[model samples]
Structure formats: structure tokens, C-alpha cells
Target: MSHRRPLPRGLRLTVTDEGPGFPPEFLPRAVDRFARAEASRTSEGAGLGLAFVQAVALAHGGTAHAENTEHGGAVTLDLPC
Candidate 1:
């Protein structure tokens, strides 16, 4: 991970990583409670992390999204204050 500077107005924050990317359809349900892109039989965690993130965004009038990165993949949350 890289050190993050305070966001600048009109500039978007991007988070990227090298990891297995989720399917396109997964985005629609990424915030669903207990919905795990990787089945519990294979993946770790109870799958609440993303849901929690989405909740925080909605609560703050922001937004969250997931997309395939050119090299790896990433999930991005944009909050306007």
C-alpha cells in the first residue's frame, strides 16, 4: 500500500491491487448483506467488510464501486464532502 495524501478537490482517488478480479455481475450485489463473491467454502471472512463500506458511503452521501484494473483489480469508494 502507498502512503495516501489528503484528497484534493476535483481529483479522484484510485485504489489498485494485484489479485483475482470478481465477475462483472458481482458488482450489483457487492454490497448485499452476507453476499460473498467467493463462496465461504473457499474464501475467508464473513463477507461483511464490503457491505459495511457501502453502508458508510450511503450514510455519508458518497458511493462505492468495484472494477477490473488494467493490471490487477480494485474496489473504489468516492465520498464528497
Candidate 2:
């Protein structure tokens, strides 16, 4: 976790997985409602997890981010403390 400097009084939380990571094309829409990576479509999920996370961050006057790391995917939520 990290401090939100010059932005707000909050903390940024990040979660990452050591999986195949997300597709490049899906990065832009990763936080969209119901958006899911093709590899996850076959799994059990409604694809709203990230969307909900983003919504909560926004509601808290913060933001959310997603990205594919060298070894996996990462999702981050910045929220007011």
C-alpha cells in the first residue's frame, strides 16, 4: 500500500496474481462493467468484481487501476482513509 500524495488523503491497495495476466487489448476496458478477460470467461464470475471495485473507489473520491504485470495481473484501488 502507498500514500495518495497531492491527490487525497487515502491509501492505495493492490492485488496481484501470478497467472497468465490480462491481454493487452483488454487493459483499457478492464475496469468497465461486466468486462472480463477472455481466459476468465469460462470461469465462474459475473465480471462485475473490478467494476464494483472501481465504483467503490469513485464513491470514496478515489480511483481504480488495472494492469498486466510481467508475471500476472494487478488490480489496485485507491480510497480515502
Candidate 3:
């Protein structure tokens, strides 16, 4: 699922997945380069996905957030409108 909300200062875009979500320890380093949870170490991902998202958001003077919701994992990008 995706949600787009317009705040007074910017736009909030959130994307969510119904998978098992990120590991507790991995959440803190989810945006770190080459960081991956054991559950994902064997996956095809290089673990740079969230890092790239964070980079782009920071470069654009915005912010990036990732967390596990009741449903699953979610990544939100708050960018200037």
C-alpha cells in the first residue's frame, strides 16, 4: 500500500509491503551501506536500497524514514513540494 499526504511544508509519500518486515536490529541501520539483516543476507538485494532512498531525500532537503507497521514494513519520503 501507498499513502501520499500533503503537509504544510511538504509531501509525505509512504510505501508499504506485507512481508515479514525488517528485523529489529536492522531497522537502525537500514539506511547504512551494505547493511543487511541475516534474514536478507542470502537474498538478491545488495542492501543499498534504503541507503539510496535516504541519500536522495537528504540531497533534496527532505527526510527518509523506515519502520515496521502492524501490517509490515514501510518507507516514507518527505520531500518538498
The C-alpha TM-scores of every prediction are 0.72, 0.80, 0.90
Q: Name the better of 1 and 2 by TM-score.
A: 2
**What is the C-alpha lDDT profile of model 2 across 1-81, one tens digit per residue?**
233243357687878888888888998999999888885366888789999989999998889989877868888887776
On lDDT, the candidate that comes out on top is: 3
How far is 19's C-alpha from truth in model 2 (Å)?
0.5
Clashes of each: 0, 0, 0
**Residue pairs with backbone atoms closer than 3 Å in model 2 (clashes):** none
Give the number of colliding residue pairs in candidate 1. Answer: 0
Cα error, candidate 2, residue 64 (Å): 0.4
Candidates in descending lDDT order: 3, 2, 1
Kindly list the per-residue Cα lDDT of model 3 for residues 1-81, writing each as its tens digit: 999999898999999999999888888888887777775356598878889999999999999978999999999999997
Ranking by TM-score: 3, 2, 1
Clash list (residue pairs), candidate 1: none
Candidate 1 runs further than 4 Å off: 1-12
Please say which candidate is ahead in lDDT: 2 or 3. Answer: 3
